[model samples]
Target: MVRPLYPINAPTYLRLRDQIRADIEGGCWRLGQHLTLNELSAHYSVSNVPVREALLQLQGDGMVDMRMNRGAVVLDVNERFIDEYFDIREALQSMLMTRACQRRGGGVLMQAKVLLGRVDEAMREGKVRQLLEADHALQDAIGHMGDNEPAMAMLASRSRLLEAFRRARLDLLTADLMQLPVQGLAMLLAIEHGDPGSGCEAVRRHVAAMRAYMKKLLKIPEGRSRADASLVNVPTFTRARESTAAMPEASSTEPASPAVASPGPPTVLPLSLPPGRRLDPEGDGSNDNRSTDDGLHPPKR
Candidate 1:
């Protein structure tokens, strides 16, 4: 299924909830910041109920919190929580990689190789969104290769959390982020040859590099260092699991948001992202073209 620009058939609350999630992931909302239902509803042009519902959903995801009188506030990252989060990610994704290697096909391998080239193109032009999308496509292809619906779904879900964490660390490691393609391209080559063992080793090294980069960015030792160092001194999130359960069923019809203006300078976006998903930093879609797989892909932003 294609990822919706907004929540599918969701009430205003759900729509607002999803937008908030997107905004948080987009860094539109800073950690430790409090958001009122009225404020969000106004911003998203929805009613208070949907906004409240959305905040509640975020709360459940440990991204927001509710106080006795305060509506909701963005959560601050804590050392313990961040470490636990990625620890879970490493465990799940490692399993996914192993499974994909066992039965991966030539088609999937070929697609991955093409995607890595897209990654190279995006990196050359410094297109952050393209890079992000290309990375997701590569990983999602691997997830599909696993041939297990549950594994694919789990990887998609967990990847979002990891994406948020990685995005937070991007600015701190300018050099490493720019150099990602070197290591990433090499990893894809290993995967393309059907060397599961090589793929595993390549991915493991990549993850280690990521961990090391984060540690260096935060000026802490690897493994022992907590990822929360990036968000320490930020505000804490209040739990909102109860709110997600409260969501009503999806609606049959709802209007999508108006298309956002294109980023200038000729950047070509996959038709799936279309217009309105975001503006290119460069504005020109074609200026920073990259190969993108067709279909409704998983969320990276």
Candidate 2:
């Protein structure tokens, strides 16, 4: 008799649940396909107990439906469901951006820059998976900057499903890969400059763009307008000058010194896509060495 190989540290049921969920998202099991305990037990070489527990957990996650006659059926991911999922993501991500801007430190800035560099490298190579992974890491780093455990937990709860969907649609994302790094750079700049308003706006724009693109690809109707969207209004941080001006002057006996001139705003690199030039997933190989006005060059192969 052959022995079943279970995970070393984690619970067997949880591991089985994840594997089953992944298979469902990866399109291995079509919608309404029945998952039987006997088949799953033979497939994983595990007994019926763990398989049943995993299926029950998946049913709770809405990935599978338990019925009277049917064992376990893969749930349908409808258009409305996708919209609601993204709505939750947008609100939580906006909150994270606002808090990250408030709590960003030097280390966070450095890490963001490094992650962006990786994104740029991935884009240059036309590697969609690498680009997505790098961008995900960048977002995760920013979320950690906020130091909010509950918010991170909420975001993490749906992370596996999110990743699985993206993985299954890698081909559809190739066309939009060009804009991904640019959007990421914009968010990084906003965070680095301590501009919470821009950071939140960037998050909103990124999510909206992604939702629009995915809807278009899936042929789903745009159900609601931006004005009617159920999104969280994340309060922006006040400017440093405004906050300082609001405080009463300190009473001092010392003589006043001459005012020193403050420096101008730091110059920002222009990272916009060129006008009338659509993003070509296939390289044109024409402007490889071109540099923008702000001294930032396009990613080279």
Candidate 3:
């Protein structure tokens, strides 16, 4: 009698949804890969009923695309998607922070402090997953303080996907790992002191930082570029100093600390071709032979 990994009493579809979402976020399914009902059912040892239902739920989460004949295909994670994601996030987070500051309560403030402490601990230990979870929890606490159900609901809908993206690209964020929590703390302190303006600004600045980091990670151009189309072959992360060595230095208002400061320039992850993949310099995939269904072939258990 072996115990099940998920709770036995939970609905089958819900369990399947969690498993599938985990696989999708874990890079088990690549961009544009079709997910067939029969294959998923067989892979998870579940019936088609649960698999279909779970995929429908995931579709609503914006994690998959359900076509007329294609069934479910992994959604494309592209520049447009990232831009829209951060835009929505910045608006929602600013609203939540403003309202939270307006409705500040001692209990919620104390809870936020506790959550921030957890974030700091996770950061110090270099536990990326724990740090992300704790940071999200802290944000949730702040949002709850506002008691804006609709706003919070919108934020929750896409939170997991955003977290998954950040988690997957941790290598590009070594500098951000330290800077972000400090921003979170600043936002929390502004809320604690009932400073809505400062709080909202803090939230916006934090989101801006994230937006910049993500754009750099994805190699998304600020404007149109010839190199945009060839981004399908994602580059590996490199150190900020190495990436920004050729750029001129810029002045900073914030005092520098040994832990956060880079020796060369501001941290940035520049594009470099990954090994074993040929990319055309003209932003075309003509030279690349990589499969679009990169993760469709699951390993045998």
Best by TM-score: 2
Candidate 2 lDDT over residue span 1-301, tens digit each:
1123566987889888877876766667665578788888888899988988898887776667786645687765556766887798789888888877776633677767777777766554444456667777877777888778788767765555544454444223333445566667767767777778878777776666656545543542322212211111112312222433453443377433422325653223343444544332222224333343211244455
- How displaced is residue 122 in candidate 2, in Å? 2.5
Q: Specify the poorest-scoring 10-residue window by lDDT in model 2.
A: 225-234
lDDT for model 2 comes to 0.60
How high is the CA lDDT of each candidate model?
A: 0.53, 0.60, 0.62
**Which is the leading candidate under lDDT?**
3
Stretches off by above 4 angstroms in model 3 are 1-11, 121-130, 174-177, 219-301
What's the best-to-worst order under lDDT?
Answer: 3, 2, 1
The TM-score of predicted model 1 comes to 0.58
Structure candidate 2, residue pairs in collision: none
Cα lDDT tens digits, model 3, 1-301, are 1113776699899889878888766667655579999889889999988988898999898888887655698776666887898799888888888778787744677667667767765554444456666777877788888788888777776655654554445333354554455566667767767888877776776676666666665654222111111111223323333433433333466532312212552221111223554323221234423333211111255
Q: Candidate 1 lDDT, tens digit per residue, 1-301?
A: 1455754565666556666777776677766688887777677787777667777777776777886556787766555545665566566556766677666543576666666666656554444445656766766676576667776665554444444544555323233344455445544545545556666655655554455444443443212122222111111211122222343433458532322435554322232234444322221233222323211122355
| Stretches > 4 Å off in candidate 2 | 1-10, 25-27, 173-176, 219-301
Report clashes for each candidate as comma-separated counts. Answer: 26, 0, 0
